[model samples]
Target: MKAISYSRYGGPEVLEYGDLREPKVGPDSVLVKVRAAAVNPVDWKAREGYLDPVLDAVFPVVPGWDVAGVVVGLGASVTEYAVGDEVIGYVREDFLSRGTFAEYVGAPVRTLARKPRNLTWEEAAGLPLTGLTAYQVLVKALRVQRGETVLVHAAAGGVGSIAVQLARHLGARVIGTANERNHDYVRSLGGEPVTYGEGLAERVRGLAPEGVDAAFDTIGGDTLKVSAQLLVPEGRLVSIADGDVVSYGGRYSFVRPDADDLTRLAELAEQGVVSVHVFETFPLERAADAYRRNEEGGTRGKIVVTVAWDTAGPDA
Candidate 1:
């Protein structure tokens, strides 16, 4: 299968686009013919060895997690899907290997969900990881409630964009941080926009004088500190970017692959309660460029990589 892979951890220069061996279907996995894949920050992070301590790399790692594709084959024990079914998955394994950047990925059933009919294949590819991260942190970690004021950092970015919509659905008033340029975009997601950086806590206070009832921090470091300071007494806080949130009486979260949760997100997408904004897309052969784009940051929604076997050209 043609794919993007790296034999050693480094920069974007290490991502090689070429042919690799096909994956085998396991008893608990299904083989998906990749139609599109989302380039997440974690993809580049893994490529650079940032996740080295947690996930051992089986060199020649194919890096990607979020995928929207068709099921081409199924494992012996899998009955949830079959050939020809369009699906989306956060196809993460315990290690760095067998990822969705390839033409085919053997995804465990736990990571798969039906693609939302309302979303294009590229848009659907962006949903799983970012959607699940936002949903889990809002529903489980923060437990945001109706009528509560919530502060979400980096609100116009992938996870934050979804967080704003989902938080609004839960009845929480959302205050999202973005540059002045994206304030309108944040408001469109049902969040009150607040320019991030200096005086962030004060700006949030201007919106809710008593401080927020919950805070979702996607940009850690200084932003996490600002969020901690903007919370009302006993207000909940969760951060995915930094584990130091524990020191601020907040929980640090990592998104998990839960079919049930992914399904709920799909339902929300279908119902028009939440939608993925596809900021840009690149062909599979240009995956390195996709990684560089994501690494540059400030992305409004998602940067997706598409696989069209019939149309793919030689790698640049």
Candidate 2:
């Protein structure tokens, strides 16, 4: 098998592509034939060692968390899926082992689910981590309600794009933050788009004169600081992209994968209530280029790395 890995953490340059041994499945794991993988900010953050303490990785880490692929094999105890089932999942982040960057990787059955029939491999690849994060933040952490005003910072980014759509589906008036370039894209997702950077509070205030009921901050630092002002008293404010929770005198949260939450997101995708927007796709060989584009931070939606599936099993 061919895999991209890093013996040490630093920059995109740390990622190396070469031949590697195939993964061995565990008693409770499934071995997926990697069709496509999603790249999130977390990928780059992990590459930079930002998750060192939490992930507790040894050297030579594989930096990808999202996988959308076909199951070629499963553990002996697995009953939920059989060989050749299409699936997608957010790999557990705390434990750092070989990730979705490889040709084949082992994933626990609990974290994996049936892929939405409506999405392509590339699009489905982009959904797991970002979609789960958005669903958990809005539906669980924030407890968003119908007819309430919800503000999402960095709304055109990976997680933000889904958060905006999910909020709209839940009957909230969605307001999203992006730059002027992506305002139209955000609006298409059922959000009143506001340009982020500088006076974000005022821009949101103009849209929500009554004050926002909740906020989902995907970009931390100043964005998290500014998001605090958009909420009404006791309103929920959660940041998942941050390494640490921001204390904003409201509900701060970290995204955790629950089987139920992923099922709901899949249901929404199945019903056409939410759309997975994939902005770019790169071959696994061009992962460095993908990282450069994601670092630019102007993408309208998610970026993904599509592992080639045309050739397989040491023959290509």
Candidate 3:
């Protein structure tokens, strides 16, 4: 099978496209015929070896977190899905050491959810990582209620795009930060668009005047620092990026692969309660290029990698 991998962690240039053996199923895993996968900040960060502290990677690593695919075979112990179900999932971070950047990847049955019938694989591919992150942050971490004002930094981003829609759907008035170029796109996602760099706090004050009730902080550094000060007395601040803000305010690492959450997100996608926007798509052979684009930033939504597969063969 063709897959993207790096023998040593360094830059995107280290990624190589070549043939490798297909993964065998574990007792609780499903062998998925990869269709589409999305790139996240973690993909590039892992490629450059930045997450060595939290996740240990053995090289010849394939780094991707979001996967949309069809089940070609099932583990002996698995019963949630059959041999021909279509699904989408957040493959565990450790699994990315040999990830969805391949024609075939194995996902545990617990992580896989039926892909929404309304979306193409490309769109479904874009949802798992970002959609789940946004859902968990708003519905669980902050517990944002209707009529409250919520600020979402990097609002045009993969996670933020979904976050904005979910916040609005939950009845919060969402104030999103993006550059002038992405303001229209952010607004379409149901957020009030605002320029992000410098004087961001003042802009929020001018709009809401009473400060925000809560914030979903995706950008670290100055953004997180500033958001902390903007929170109301009992407001929440949750971040996905690495930083020390937990010592100062509300914080939670994204909730991983909760079957119930994935199921709910799938239903929302089908119902059009929210959408995952895909700004770019690449073939597995161009995995290096995909990571480079994600690192450049300013993207309005998720970037996906299409893993093209041939006809099914005998199962391993």
Best by lDDT: 1
Instruction: Give lDDT tens digits, candidate 3, residues 1-316.
Output: 8889888878888999998888878999999889999999878887787877778787778778789998988899998998889999988744347588888888887777899999989999999888889999899989999999999989999999999999999999999999999999998999999998789889988888888999898988888888888888888898888467687666856558877899899999999998878899998899889999998999978889997667856342
lDDT of 1 at 98: 89
lDDT of 1 at 211: 92
The whole-model lDDT of each prediction reads 0.92, 0.83, 0.86
User: In model 2, where is the ten-residue run with the lowest total lDDT?
Assistant: 242-251
What lDDT does model 3 reach? 0.86
TM-score of 3: 0.97
- Candidate 3 residue-pair clash tally: 0
Which scores higher on TM-score, 1 or 2? Answer: 1
What tens-digit string does per-residue lDDT give for candidate 1 at 42-83? 888888999999999998899999999998888999989988
Number of the candidate with higher lDDT, 2 or 3 = 3
User: Which clashing pairs does model 1 show?
Assistant: none
Ranking by lDDT: 1, 3, 2
